[model samples]
Target chain A: MARRMLNQDLIEALTDNCAPIRPLPHPAWRALVWFAVSLCYVAIVVAAMGVRPDFVAKISDPQFATELAAAFLTSVVAAAGAFSAGCPARPAWERFAAGFFLLIWMGAFAVGCWRDVDAYGVSGLLSHSDIYCLPTILAISIPAAALILSMVKRGAPIAPFVTIGLAALASTALAEAALRLSFRQDPAVSVCIWQFGSVVLLTGIASLFGRALLHWTRRDALIASFQAHRR
Target chain B: MSELSDTSNDRESRWRALMASAQDGDHAAYRELLSDLFPVLRRFVLRKWPNAHDTEDVVQEILVSIHTVRQTYDRRRPFTPWLMTIAARRVADAARSRYARGANETTVDILPETFDGDGAKSEQETRDDREALRRAMAILPAGQRQAIELIKIQGLSLDEASQVTGKSIGSLKVGIHRAIKAMRQALERNG
Candidate 1:
């Protein structure tokens, strides 16, 4: 089929009317900045909430310390993955690394839960006093998730699922760490379900809306929309 | 291996220069880059979609995709792989959409004639049908939207749509029925 030549050169419609091209920072640099931003947000949340009096005592275990370190590392790795997804042809090893650390953290959380069960029986895991865990984890994820969404919008991501997933993962993982640290909650079956479940739940939700979340500001889309309005 | 790498390096450098100039608001450089890219991108798509006659559409889609994500391109990186990755994806997506669209009308449907937009309808009737279809489609689930679009509007055979979209023929058939039912309900409520 013969193609109709576009009346106005699309190049002119683009370069002449569109905003000036901005130089993209390296994906690693962008990821580092996102990591720092999320870290500062966590710091603020901790300062505002006030660290639990027993925080030092609870975090004393080598295993617990490793869990905290793993959480922080997961955020950093996942941030890298999120940023890298925006760039075409970039390696996604950062995302893979994030997944690896996430599994490790999951195992650590399970261990912590097992310890809690050992001391406090299976029924004791669902303490009425800890209902705040659900809301806190979800609330903490918001600002970080928003920041990631804003940053990722600056470029197109080939794997929208990976980009959105990593963004949700990085933000929620860090929040979980920050909340667990400052609030001093021992992992229990119910507590773990509410805290870590929030991240898994949000990530699953993000996958559904990934395509809509990252709208490509293509000139064609703009022009077609304009023509549609005129019609 | 060394020779191939060397040549690859050289091409990357040239493309990077073109992109840099384009980034600096050089229209000439931008035009040159796009013009140079078109054939290469077309060939790239054709390689994957060898039998696809409408490679032109795929080429245009690739260009739009490139333009959409142009800011994400790192000048320091080789441009070829990035371009090829997009080309490959666009071709695959187009093929998928086409594949899934091939089956809208199936044997289970009681009234096969309603949504097909046969020529017997007057201009006003056609307009009303289109309007109702549009509103119904906007509210349809994405899967249903795809089915209605490829099969209903584009008039692609279910088998053809299925080939591109990778959806089972039965699924597309069901989607069309669901879409038509929804549209009828919407039109009735509005009426």
Candidate 2:
């Protein structure tokens, strides 16, 4: 009888608190939306920073173009994975969709490194210190990160770390791609070590704060509001 | 087996429709959906956490989680997986928290108590001390007793004691000094 009463009370409170909500669009759709917005923002940042002088020439090079395209796809797919992670009961595979693209991106970098090593021995892989890489990528990725964080918060926090990690990956990969278009860094090794390294580092760091970013705020608010209603 | 699958399918379709209505702010549908989910969630929690002491609480938590993230449910998707996913996640979370709590707790047959300092005295000892003090106070002269009461017992300054007793501060101080010496001697003699 007591259990029944408690259940009744909870049900009444929940029903009273119910409000109409528009369900989230498919994760793929949401990912595309995020991609479009972040891409535009990244483009504006690139334009503002002034495109690298060899941008046209770099795009004409198949290796450079392939790496850039792979990075861009990784960003979009990772965004989708992040969104998929936020939704419960989506196929677990959806959360790993970005991994394939991530490998391709990494593979492109590996090939570039091999080419540089073949051309100029071990010395060709060496470049002057680029202290600006980490901070510049971070600055470019901030808006994209914030936008994805906000979008993902609307979904469940069932896989917070994975969701946040993928979201961070998406933003940072896009940012690195944009950075490449605007900044000239010599040697594929330097690009791999500095620019790509920044993305990996930032993504790992951001993911560590996933539980802090995504939590059951709505449930807490509902409980508080219901208690207030009872009072 | 086919009958069981058919029942599962029916349940899945019904729950999906009910959830869709709940998202549209249909209160009755929401209530009915929660009522239906409660028993299933309870069973899920039990299966996931066989020795759970708070099965109902975990079930309620799952329900609350579902309500919180209702918007995340895609109407096109099968409802059972969505609901079960949340249920399983909540049950796992509950298990984790229980383990963490258990790790932090020390199980003892008897509750451990705080230490009593060596300076602390028994009630009988306290009573004896009070009685001895009373006897000592009784042996003092009237002036000395008044001085001792005002200064020592009442915690008044010499100036305040003098004011209250209509005596000079110096005289009050002398009275207190003599009163203490006399009490100490009296207590020693009694011992």
Kindly report the root-mean-square deviation of model 1 from the true structure over all alpha carbons: 9.1
DockQ of candidates 1 onward, in order?
0.20, 0.22
State the lDDT of candidate 2 residue by residue for B64-124, as single tens digits. 8888899999999998899888888888887887899999998899654533432466777
Q: B26-115 in candidate 1: lDDT tens per residue?
A: 877777778778888778888888988778767776777777678888888878888887777778777876777756535565555654
True contacts kept of each: 0.37, 0.57
Candidate 2 collision pairs: none
Under the 3 Å rule for N, CA and C atoms, how many clashes does model 2 have? 0
What clash count does candidate 1 reach? 24
Q: Model 2 TM-score?
A: 0.78
Ten residues in a row with the worst lDDT in model 2 chain A? A217-226
| Candidate topping lDDT | 2
Over A1-231, each residue of candidate 2 has an lDDT whose tens digit, in order, gives 012236667777788888999999999999999999999998899899999999888898888998899999999999999999999989899999899988888888889888998999998778667868999889889999999999999999999999999999999999999988988885888898888899999999999999878865333334543543464
Off by over 4 Å in 1: A1-8, A11-19, A113-132, A188-191, A215-219, A225-231, B1-10, B105-191
- lDDT per residue for candidate 1 within A114-184, as digits (tens), equals 78778878865665455666577779988998998899888675778878988888888888888877865
Chain B TM-score, structure 2: 0.57
